[model samples]
Target: MESNSSLGTALLPEESTETSFWRKVLDVEEVKKQVLFSLPMILTNAFYYAITLVSVMFAGHLGELELAGATLANSWATVSGFAFMIGLSGALETLCGQGFGAKTYRVLGIYLQASCIISCFFSVIISIIWFYTEPILILLHQEPQIAKKADLYMKYLIPAVFAFGFVQNVLRFLQTQSILMPLVLFSGLPFALHFGIVYTLVHWTGLGFKGASLASSISLWISLILLATYVVCSKKFEHTWGGFSSESFRHIVTNLRLSLPSAAMVCLEYWAFEILVLLAGLMPDAAITTSVIAMCVNTEAIAFNFTYGLSAAASTRVSNELGAENPGRAKTAMAVALKLVVLLALVLVLALVFGHNIWAGFFSDSTLIIKGFASMTPLLAISISVDSFQGVLSGVARGCGWQHLVVVANLVTFYGIGMPIAVLLGFKFKLYAKGLWIGLICGLSSQAATLLLITFRTRWTRIDLSAEREQGTLDSV
Candidate 1:
């Protein structure tokens, strides 16, 4: 009875043990794959983000009023419009990502179309709000002159909003497929051209401040045109993209369910930070306090762009593996991403700690403002590290189709727990900007911890793709 089966069974245990070891411990190949994936994404995102910033810079050169107006308009546009568009596109990270993994290639194109449609619809609604920026800014207690200038900037920037929506959706679509290299060229090219375009429009043309806003519109459209042309014309997407279809319309409601919660998840966290700036304005030397907080917020945003790539990579890998029915692999991908983001965050925090004075100088030469920012650097460092954790974890949540849960988590942590602590410490305790920032840290930490717990406690299991497609919900496995 010494059969071949007995001999094979004897060797199976060692093979299983080796496989389990790799699964449980650090995975070099997976880390390498993610590294390669994240770098390009970081560059692509940074380039695209700079395009808008460049426009604000050009507008600022005209005068202080133009700067204030452009800055306010930019902030309002982000809170009310850009952030939502980014959130709406997050649905594709789940749908198209898993669909690609499942080899249901055609759905990627359908989801892309559906997401674009949703973005377009929202852009229209948001445009209406942008039209009345002056009143809203006045309602928020902003100076009337500044509010009027912002309205002028926003009016010209409206067309860009629609283009921006499409760009974000396409980004998710391509990112899920691991088609990243093109993104660098698509985004980088426009960003490089944007500077010249802005300078020409603002200086060469007679448009001045208005030219800066219009330049943004043109540059964004350029990005959309390039990306859209690539997706439509390239044979690489032959399987994933079938030409326009009515099927996309059917998926609109399905996409909306996921999109809305995802938008809330992003907006809650964003608005919380914006609120801190508003709170800073209430402090006794309002000018210095507001400037310092705004600088910190800007610094944090720049830092986040670095980790955003890893977050995107995490979402893509987890979703794809889940779609392929490899739960263990999906979990491992998330682990690897978390490790990378933490290490990256450490490097960034070190830079901030050592170069706080230098970095603050870029925002303002006022010694008082610079010194104030220096005082807040350590708090900024802590918040940055905490944000890195949540960024990647949020990506995993998207991969797991848990945006709805994340929305609730953001609300509770930011508004319920974090904000109250901030108000108490900031005002009652007289911690000023530092106290307010500390409160933000509390919220961020709670959110990060909650998301981490969610990732661990929730089972990483295969999604029932057929049932989900039929029911139009990507709930828990």
Candidate 2:
């Protein structure tokens, strides 16, 4: 009798036999497992972004200047620091996910350590850039007062960058193995703790904006420590983690081959939106436009966490199936993930359409900011829907070791196509924030279409785990 651990191999069967499309799509067992694996991650990501929104809300109430300053600072941190760390850590989604499926469990720990080392090194570079943020913003023609405040906020948040790097590495490490419950527990505790910490420091202690930054940094560190402790003590990780190995140091070049392109792909998408906020700051009512646009971006970011959760699940499923040499099952996982995200996107679009005003009001009581956000809500909804599909496809690409391909696609679609249109319509035509978002929608639509085509045309059987193991590349364990 086959054990439950060997069931994935049964999913392969014989390719000579044909299966109906609907039967593959209606695989209830696979769908159930994917949903169970994805739910905790979705809730955890929602909590993570909610904490960020709460910080932004605290800053928003401090004053218009503080709101704009913190918005710019957070945007910079995301584009320059957090996105890079998350992207770099994503290499593990391929390595560890496949390693687990291939029963090369020890390699998962090695890849996790390698990812942490690289991420910490990058954090130092980002911190230095944060120290000089004021000059950089000024050079970009930002208001001098706002630039100064943004610089201060970034300076206070530097410690959190390193903390966040470890957080992301652990997140990917646990996620690839489908050990998600701890993520929810650990992340939720800090999220609840963050509000009190921010309130006490900001209002009672009179730290104001800096206090908010400090609160967030401290909360992140606490979460990291808790997560680290769990990873260390859990018996489930025993086989995968056999203490820190020097072997981690030897894989720099090999890991970078995936990490760098993954970083670029993520950075391009993230920085594009940050650029939108920066450009909005250059508009006539710089503070108001920046505030409204930032709010819209924040709202969209929360929605993104949902799709991102699905993306992670898709990556894990596809990579695991491919590693187990079940190409048919891998393709089925891709189909089911795409279907799920599209349904989620549709539900989100309706909510945004009907509840735009109420949602905007949560961020600010200012009528002007709320009104501005309302005008752009439709565009935001459309962009989110398009981005939902693209996010899942990118995950598929990562699972299939196509990060380098997607980097090129992102560059051409976002930078080559989207950025120019955004600038031309936004500044040249003076359409401002709305125009910038419209241009972004165009770019996202292009990326989604291209990735879908690529996914469809992929020769799944040719994606061999044996070849990867032989080359000592991704599956080197």
Candidate 3:
């Protein structure tokens, strides 16, 4: 009987041809696992993003001037404050992720504290800049009235920066441990509540435009409080979240080494999109060009946010596997992530291809703007495809603690190669909006290619963070 059972088990593959073929091609289970992991993260990120956008929407209905001011303020907040905060927290993806894997559990809390400290320090600096936004905008040749309105919106938005930083850092701390479902709840709840808060302030309380910015501040803090409470109270983190210690202050310098480069890696890419919008303002049909380019930027941001979940998953998987001293498994994990990215990108590109006009209509009623977006749809598709590849790769880089190398890649590719061609084609060659997007596509392709090379040529190894902890530096990498 035992021999017959063994014989039947051995012959199972012959009966299931599809399963055998997939087994030969890829790890079907791992792909499914990543897809499941990515969904919650996608929802969490989208929810957090919607909190601010919803505020802008509420304020936009007040008046055209209100809309203009609120939009500019929101964009400025993202570039100078929110993007930098998100980047600074990226260090924890490496530190906390690997530490959890290596069973150096207590170190995760210490690193989280250190990252939060760093965020607070930078938020102060950025707040000072936000305070003087009126002068800065005027200096940059913005209309004085619009600049003043932006300045008003920014001042009220300042408190949100500190909250945003803490929220992001805590997110990384939890994300690294695969504590994800709570994130969707915590982030989604605040975002849902934010709509009511903005409405009350904008309409019921009579704060007007200032209320929209202030509402974002309140909602972000709500998110932080919920997340902080969970991290503090949950038994799931008992091994990792030791109560705060003075020791974290000592690790600030170590966190900064990676955090600074991570911040630059994010900021460079973000600034490039804003720069394109600014250049559009200089075009012959500045109104139409600026509107279309801004829409494109927003469209790209939305797509990236959608893929960001997979990127986060890739980072966590690679870092955790590496920390477990399984380099081959880490490589296989990244391969699976890339495959998923390709599949997801194709779906997104197809959606954009078939529904380009419908998507554009949401942003504007102007036929000219809609037509312009339709014309740029093909280039946008290519860029989105490449951007998806790079997003996962960038997450892998964060996991590998290679932000320094990635930053240099971003600087050289986006600033050195991408921007020069954009200028030449945009102004010199007369391509205008299409030319600007084409230049951006060039940058995205170059960046994706560079990151791909780095991932392949570089060694995959875990940082001995325990050793670094004892040595007082992260140089052990």
Candidate 4:
């Protein structure tokens, strides 16, 4: 194998042909580095998701109606606010990760600012949507009671939208520099505080469902403040954190050229599940079906956090290698990240299979709801496993600046193929939630396969790292 000095390590020796592939994979120092880099990110993502799950659990304890309402509101928030902000901010993963590796330090801060600005602008529009969520839900033919309560719940979550945008911006800034510990510390600490705040507001203050929403918003702002403080005070960012600049505004269009497609790719995948929940709400037993699917989806979200961390690590590693003008190392990084995520996925699949009955009980005491969730585990396992690979592929695409291509892939597979199948089996054939989830599995599988083929066929050598460098320099000028 060709050696890649840019990784500060060498690939497996070509002469060592007798060595087993798995052993060579394990022995590679770069693989270990990638795992370590992703570990903290995974933990941080877990805590972030945990905070939301806790809110949902709190709502579940109040009543089934409350649970359904909270789930609907939360789903809308994710589709309208969180996914868009996170996806748009992913432009940083490409720009900042490569910038850091290329030693173009200042560009990272500039990109971070640009992403923050754009995300904040979009948040305003999303917040307005949230303000009218009740009407929107009614328009979609949702149950009137659930729509009313969910709208009330979404009202308190509006502030968190902007806070979330800032958090993503700062997180990307630190992530690209290989700074993972602060993210863990800040996110984990707020998550602990979140439970207490939620309990107090919901029980002691008698705010009910609104309290749970407020708790989520408050926790996000706290995390955002802590992270922002660290970025300002930490010496690690001395080179990257040049104070705010007018350049951020100027680069808005340039950054959107990447961010919009990224947003589309991510939103399409995320909204597909949200749409599943919406479809379930219109089924025979709206409350039970929506509640059950929401619980299962939450479980999948937790697992997705693990894969998402791997994706982030892949993006950083691949972008770093490419920025260093080592396409060979970039390819190696992708291969290593994929292998690690697949192993993790298999382990998760087994755990979900064995623990399905027990896991569903965590969210609700209702036997019917637990049984409903358990029935979906097999399909969830399949979807989650395939989605793990798809997630990392998306990260790789982001690093390679192939966001536009993936957007097309996501739209075709998810909408053109998956949605029609879901609607057919779910409603026409009356397979209900199972049919919807199975459709999602098919969509993920198609997306994963398509991305894999693209990665395989890519001409990495054709990437013009110098031209990217020149463009960044010109933008700064």
Clashes of each: 0, 0, 0, 0
What residue pairs are clashing in model 3?
none
TM-score each candidate. 0.90, 0.93, 0.92, 0.94
RMSD of each: 5.8, 6.2, 3.2, 5.4
How high a TM-score does candidate 2 get?
0.93
Candidate 1 lDDT, 1-477, residue by residue in tens:
678889998999999999889766768789988999999999988887778878977786676567556766777787888888989999998888888888888888888999999999999999999999989877887667767888999999999999999999999999999999999999999999998999999999989899998999999999999999999999999998999998788889888878888899899998888788767756787556766776687788778888899999999998888888888888899999998887999999999999999877655556887899899998999999999889999999888789999999999999999999999999999999999999999999999999988888885664443325657443321
Local distance difference test, candidate 1:
0.86
List where candidate 1 sits over 4 angstroms from the true fold.
Answer: 1-25, 61-66, 284-288, 365-367, 462-467, 470-477
| Stretches of candidate 3 exceeding 4 Å from the true structure | 1-11, 15-17, 63-65, 285-288, 461-477
State which candidate, 3 or 4, has the greater lDDT.
Answer: 4
Every candidate's lDDT: 0.86, 0.85, 0.85, 0.86
lDDT per residue (tens digit) for residues 145-176 in model 3: 76688899999999999999999999999899
| Candidate 2 segments whose C-alpha is farther than 4 A from its true place | 1-25, 466-470, 473-476
User: Over all chains combined, what TM-score does candidate 4 have?
Assistant: 0.94
Ranking by TM-score: 4, 2, 3, 1
Candidate that scores best on TM-score: 4
